[model samples]
Target: MRIAITGSTGLIGTALVRSLTADGHHVVRLVRRPPRTPDEVEWDPRRQWVDTDGLAGCEGVVHLAGAGVGDHRWTAAYKKTIRDSRVLGTAALAEALASLDTPPRVLVSGSAIGIYGDTGDRETDESTPPGHGFLADVCQEWEEAAGPAAEAGVRTVFARTGLVVARGGGAWAKLFPLFRLGLGGRLGSGSQYWSFIALHDHVAALRHLLDTGTLSGPVNLTAPRPVTNREVTAVMGRVLHRPTLCTAPAPALRLALGEMAGDVLASQRVLPRRLLDSGFSFAFPDVESAVRAALTDTR
Candidate 1:
């Protein structure tokens, strides 16, 4: 299948491209810069412009381009950047797909589990209503921005991904160094649940969403077993042969990380209800397995 993907160089996007190409599918990367190769197409999301014609032969689309939520301090300005990056880019891509002479059969747009803010001890899924917080609001708008594709009769699936347990990028990237150096500790009260999935399963889930014709709306991408921050500290320490004796109190985290600390402290015991219901199995479902998969080549 011929597919077009945005954020093609990102942590998840990069892995998705590798997986798809390995499966013998043609992949086209949508870029902000001018097209440098036949597999690249140019588009400026800030300008809200996409070359619909250039995307003519794509049978599917995955809109994964967005600003890194944790890349900067969560100043009011950077928060706006995060929201605009997702909302604007998704809206533009959906519009372009709607205008295509032969629109893609499916659109697997990016979303985040943050939509269910502070799940606390409660385990939520895609069917659960949105929760309170700035990130939740952004996620709501991010998924809704793809209304054009659904309205155009194309299958649209929102991938509400959890924290990916990959060593190369995302939170795990920073965690690996800290844990390896024996400087790692639990965040906040060490009780908040951290829903996570291995990068291998994450990439596979996106491809599954693209092919699952009957699946639409929100589908969470997370492991079956969610672990708390304290448990995570223990797992990291065990996996790296280190001691887990340190802790980052909530107040100190707030002081050091500012608004970003709230996210770190937030609890999300999310389950992949929809993904499981759709017959998808995780490659790394347990915390130990996920950690090992990220650190070593268990594949």
Candidate 2:
């Protein structure tokens, strides 16, 4: 299979590329820069320009391009960047795929569990209604932009990802150093459910989606068991052999993160019901075991 991917430099995309290539599939990158090699295709999502002809031969497309939600302060401009990056990129890619002579059979576009907003402690699956807020709106629009391919009879799967736990990137990476230094703590009341999945499982789930033709629409790419912030802190402390006594006050987080503080303080208890029902077994379903494997995995 020939796979084309956007945001190939991102943590998830990087892992997916390696996984697909190791499985003996040809991988092409939809890059923002000019194409310098046969495996790279140039496109500017902001300008709504893509080389449809170049991507015509692709068997599948994994759209992972987007501005990092936690990478910057949520200023008005940065918020727009976050929204535009996903919507425009998705729209452009879908349009290109729709115009292809041999359009890809599958489009595994990126999404987030944030689409469900603060679900409290409710276990949300693919069938649950979307919640409110900025992140939700962005996710809704992002998935909607892929309508073109879906309408054209292409199998479009939205990877509604959760907080990916890895040693070098994502939420876990940011927390590791703090926990290692004995400065780790829980956020807010430490009761908000934090839905997370190990990066290895995340990549594996994506691969499963690519291979499974019956899976489509929004698939919750999360773990079976979700933990609270306090539980997460305790596990990190245990893994690092540190005390979980430190705590970040809500006031300080609000002062520093401003409106984005809710993202850290809020809870989203999600479940991968669809994936599990479809017989996709997880490599790491528990927080402690997932953390240990991710921290120790060499590849």
Candidate 3:
């Protein structure tokens, strides 16, 4: 199968490309810069432009391009960057795909469980109505931006992902080092739930979305069992054979992260009901196994 992927250099995208190519599938990378290789295509999401010529003949498209939400302090400008990056990019890609004479069979658009806002201990699935807050508003707009693709009869699946467990990137990248030095512990009250999925499972779930013709709309890419921050800290310590003694106070985190701290401390107990109902299974469903998998899956 021929597939086109945006943000192919990102942690999730990179791993997905590798997994697809390992099975002899052709992969086209949509890059921001000039096309440097035969498999490269140029796109500028801010301008709502993409080289559709390079996306031709693609059977599947995975749109994951976006500014990192946690990469910078959430100043007014940075928050705009985060929102615009996802909304505008998704709009551009969806429009481009919709315009194709022969559109791809499916589009696995990236989304987040942040759509549920601070769910506290309440469990959420795909059927739950979107919640309130900044990330929720951004995520809702982000998914809605893909309307063109769905309207054009292209199957659009929003992969509402959770906190991916991996040593390579995301929040885990910073946490792994601290935990290795025996400085890892719970955040805020340590009671907040974290819906996490192993990197291996995350990539596999993306592929599942691409292949599953019967599935559509928002599908949470999270483990069935969500764990709390305290449980996660314990798992990390157990997996790395280190002591978990540090505790980051909510006030300290807020002072450091500004508006972004609310997201960090928010509790989201998300579940992969759609994925599981469609016959997708997680390789690491529990906190301990997920942490262990993150330790081994460097990519």
Candidate 4:
């Protein structure tokens, strides 16, 4: 398969690109700057511009360009940046693909489990309606921005991703070192459910979305079972042979992360119902396996 990907340098995108190219697939990376390599394509979401010629012959496209939610303190301006980066970027990419003479067979646009905000102790799936809060709103808009591709009859799938557990990047990148040093603990009350998936599983799920013809709309990219923060702490301790005695109080976290802390502490028991029903299997289905995979860099 010849695939085109935005945010090809990001955590998930990087892994997906590696996995695809390793399997003899041609990968084109969409970048914001001028093309620096033969496979590089320049695009500007803010300007609503995409070099369509570069997208020619793409059998699939995985749109993953977005501002990191935890990259900066949630100031008003930075919040807008987060929203625009995903929503506007998706819209631009979708429009570009829709205008293509031969659109890709699949459009795996990025979404997040944050769409179901603060689902405390409640299991939610792709069928659930949008939740409240900033992330939820942004995710909703992000998925909606892909309307053009679906409207143009391209198979568009919204990958509502969960907390990716990996040593390479994302939240787990910071957590791995802390837990290894016995400095890691649960955030806030330590009871919030976290729906997590291993980096390998995430990459596989993306490929499944590209290859599976039946999948479309909001397909969650999460593990089967969701664990609480306390449970995750225990698993980390067990996996790393370290102590999990520390704790970050809610007030302290709120002060530290600003508005983003709420999301950090939010309880979302997301399940990959669609993925599972579609016969997708997880390499790491539980928190312990995921942590071990992250620590050992094993699939």
Residues 1-299 of candidate 4 have per-residue lDDT tens digits of 88999999999998999999999999999999999899999999998899999999999999999999888999999999999999899999999999999999999999999999999998899888899999999999999999999999899999999999998789878898998899999899999999999998999999999999999999999999999999999999888899999999999999999899999999999989999999999989999988888778743
Clashing pairs in 2: none
Ranking by lDDT: 3, 4, 1, 2
**In lDDT terms, how accurate is model 1?**
0.92
lDDT of 4 at 148: 96
Q: Ten-residue segment with the worst summed lDDT in candidate 1?
A: 290-299
CA deviation > 4 Å runs, candidate 3: none
In order, the Cα lDDT scores of the candidates are: 0.92, 0.92, 0.94, 0.93
Off by over 4 Å in 4: none
Per-model TM-score, in order, reads: 0.98, 0.98, 0.98, 0.98
Error of 1 at 105 (Å): 0.2
| Displacement of the residue 1 alpha carbon in candidate 2, Å | 0.4
Q: Which ranges of candidate 2 are over 4 A from the true structure? A: none
User: Each model's number of backbone clashes?
Assistant: 0, 0, 0, 0
Q: Model 2: what TM-score?
A: 0.98
Worst 10 residues of 2 by lDDT: 167-176
The window of 10 residues in a row where model 3 has the poorest summed lDDT is 290-299
Residue 34 C-alpha lDDT in model 3: 98
